[model samples]
Target: MRTTLWALPVVLSIGLGTGSLAQQRSVTTVGSVMQLMDAMTIPASNAVFNVGRQPPETDEEWSALALSAVVLAESGNLLLIRDRARDEAAWTEASQAMVEAGAAALGAVEARDVDALLDAGDVVFGSCEACHATYLKRE
Candidate 1:
């Protein structure tokens, strides 16, 4: 009877602890990787892509450019989140590349430099393509 009582509490405690851990694991609010790319990355990057070809003329337009760069940079970090990374090293490298490219774009936008913005766009596109080629399995 003593052992039974003692073991019951131990088992219950472990069960409760694991249950909490499982709940914590399920707390990923960000949708799947594809959803993030479609909803956030694509739209934000479009803003950056439009910069040189259709340069921002107003403060509002410039603000949008800056916002896009910020989104891109942050989204790169988002890709590095647990379970989202396809391969740790490759994924980290690609995500860091995106951050660098986004930073470059932000710098160009701040400077209002069309040439630099265009170059930044190219870098951003290249980084995205490389990452996609490695991980994205198109259906």
Candidate 2:
């Protein structure tokens, strides 16, 4: 598949990022992260439809957002754990950027950050793409 589509995550224009989740943990945790990646599109789809419009302002929407963030974060954390040669800090920054990309996308639309909204579209995509590149390939 087109893994490159989500290769960037949320660049947030920062000095790259990574995650804090440690590797060599229980397999279940890693599996959970995989599951989260698998579920990533669920909330993102909802958010896409809701963005620039009346999002699911109810608890459901909030929950969806939170869920999305966790999945995104987990993948980033996984990346951090997987890539020994990969710079930890950069991965973490990238992971946060990925999270921020989604958040920024929503926030941009909420605050009408038209440019950010436009930029986030790709940023968020990169986040998903990047994670899939490493993890999905593993599976």
Candidate 3:
């Protein structure tokens, strides 16, 4: 009887902890794949792309630029999520490209190099184009 009383609380705590673990991973996207891209990836990537045209002038602008690059990098991970990935090989390649492009953009932002940003922008756009051509082309 004494052992059961102690075990009961432990079991209940374990169950509660498991439930919270599931809640913590709340990014399981339920929307259409395109919607996810439109909502997050496209906008974040565009911010990086557009910054090349008008370079950041202030600390605040630089912060925003960095954040946009971070978002773009993280968006690639989002695409690789099991629920979002279409083809294992192709999706992995495309998402990895996004990650690499975002990293380049972030590095350029850190260095405040307009030319490098332009190069990174080309990479970012090309990555998106390649992926879309293969997997996301509208039928």
Which regions of candidate 1 fall more than 4 Å away from where they truly are? 1-29
Q: What order do candidates take by TM-score, descending?
A: 1, 3, 2
lDDT of 1 by residue, 1-139 (tens): 9999889978779779786444356547559887989887899899998876689999999998899999998889788766777676777898889989999999999998889999999999988998988887889
- The top-ranked prediction according to TM-score is 1
Query: lDDT for model 2, on a 0 to 1 scale?
Result: 0.53
- Candidate 3 has an lDDT of 0.84
Kindly give the stretch of ten consecutive residues in candidate 1 with the minimal lDDT sum.
20-29
Instruction: Sort by lDDT, best first.
Output: 1, 3, 2
Q: Tens-digit lDDT track for model 2 on 1-139?
A: 3665565454322323432223444433334544544566445534543444654456676565555544544444454445321454544566666766666665655554455655766777776666456535452
TM-scores for candidates 1 onward, in order = 0.76, 0.44, 0.75
**lDDT, each prediction:** 0.85, 0.53, 0.84
